[model samples]
Target: MNPVTAYRFITANQFAVVGASTDRSKYGNRVLRWYQAHELPVIPVNHKEATVESVPAIASIEEIDDPANAAISIITPPKVTLGVLKKAKELGIQKIWLQPGAEDKAVLDYAREAGLDIIAGGPCILVQGPSLLTHRANL
Candidate 1:
């Protein structure tokens, strides 16, 4: 639940938003916009869509060229979140940020077992991300 981890997670070579949606009312869209608004290198992960927020979307985590060098923010159902974690683990993507509804006992347990650098049961990135950026600006 460390905010520092969230900061480090996004400060990666690339950032992906899993379940990034076209629906503006959803948390998925909101989270994706957070990254975009901050002007970070971001890719949207949405299997059913060709693009999200005008950015080309990848179907899965494995589609990224360098999984080990990226961080992901997930906004899927708890069960689907577990599957995403499994894929991420198999691909060596360690930095994982599970948005509030994306985590459950099973998902957290697997993430723990997989030795993932995870942020769960903490503040959503939307809440802390701006402050973190402000801190970086001040630095």
Candidate 2:
């Protein structure tokens, strides 16, 4: 999807960052921290970790109370990401942003077939997020 549409889609929904990490240098941690820094509401989704970036991590997308209203930003490996996409589809999540290195042809194809509004092919949230602030404030 276009960056503008993707940005709007994310800001319009409840956001979540999957693949969160305790390590400060990882992309997962950076994504989580970015949302916090922007003062945006975002949950960290991590099965391995109990807490990430100081917030309790959700074990799965199934754990989100309102899956239909949420958008997930995936920063995991391609294998893990494919699995999360399947689960997210089952949970009624229609929007997803697969960060660089977390997406591959199979996953992209699956997401397309599922009719999800996806932001993939390298538009990182770390860059797009700040721009959304002005858009969000107008909402």
Candidate 3:
């Protein structure tokens, strides 16, 4: 999809980072920061109790208080991506952004089979998020 289409899909609703972490060095951690910088409502989904960029990181999607109209960023390993996708589907989440290295052909096929609108193997959230040159120009 084009950047505008992807941006629209992503910003249409609240979002959650499926593997977000508190570790400053991690991509998940940085992504959460980027989300917050954009003033987006983002929940961090991490099994650990550590908070990412001051946002509470929960263990699973089911733990989110309100998941309605939410999209998920799957930043976990390929081996665990399918499980996350299944959980997202179970929670009625239609949109997903699978970060690079977080998805494989099997995961993509499974997501398609499950009828999900997914953006996979694309640029990271940092590139496509509100920090874009387009977004900056509009500021």
Number of the candidate with higher TM-score, 1 or 3: 1
- Stretches of model 3 off by over 4 angstroms after superposition: 2-8, 131-139
C-alpha lDDT score of every prediction, in listed order? 0.89, 0.84, 0.78
The CA lDDT at 107 in model 3 is: 97
Off by over 4 Å in 1: 134-139
Cα lDDT tens digits, model 1, 10-37, are: 5677899999999999999999999998
Residue-wise C-alpha lDDT for candidate 3, range 8-81, written one tens digit per residue: 45654578888897788988878888778777788999887757677767888888665657778888998898
Candidates arranged by lDDT, highest first: 1, 2, 3
**What is the C-alpha lDDT profile of model 2 across 1-139, one tens digit per residue?**
5866575565655778998888999999999998888787789998888888788889998898888888888999999999999998889887788888999889989888988778899668898767667777777
TM for every model, in the order presented, reads 0.92, 0.92, 0.85
User: What is the overall TM-score of model 3 with all chains considered together?
Assistant: 0.85
Worst 10 residues of 2 by lDDT: 4-13
RMSD of each predicted structure: 1.8, 1.5, 3.0
Off by over 4 Å in 2: none
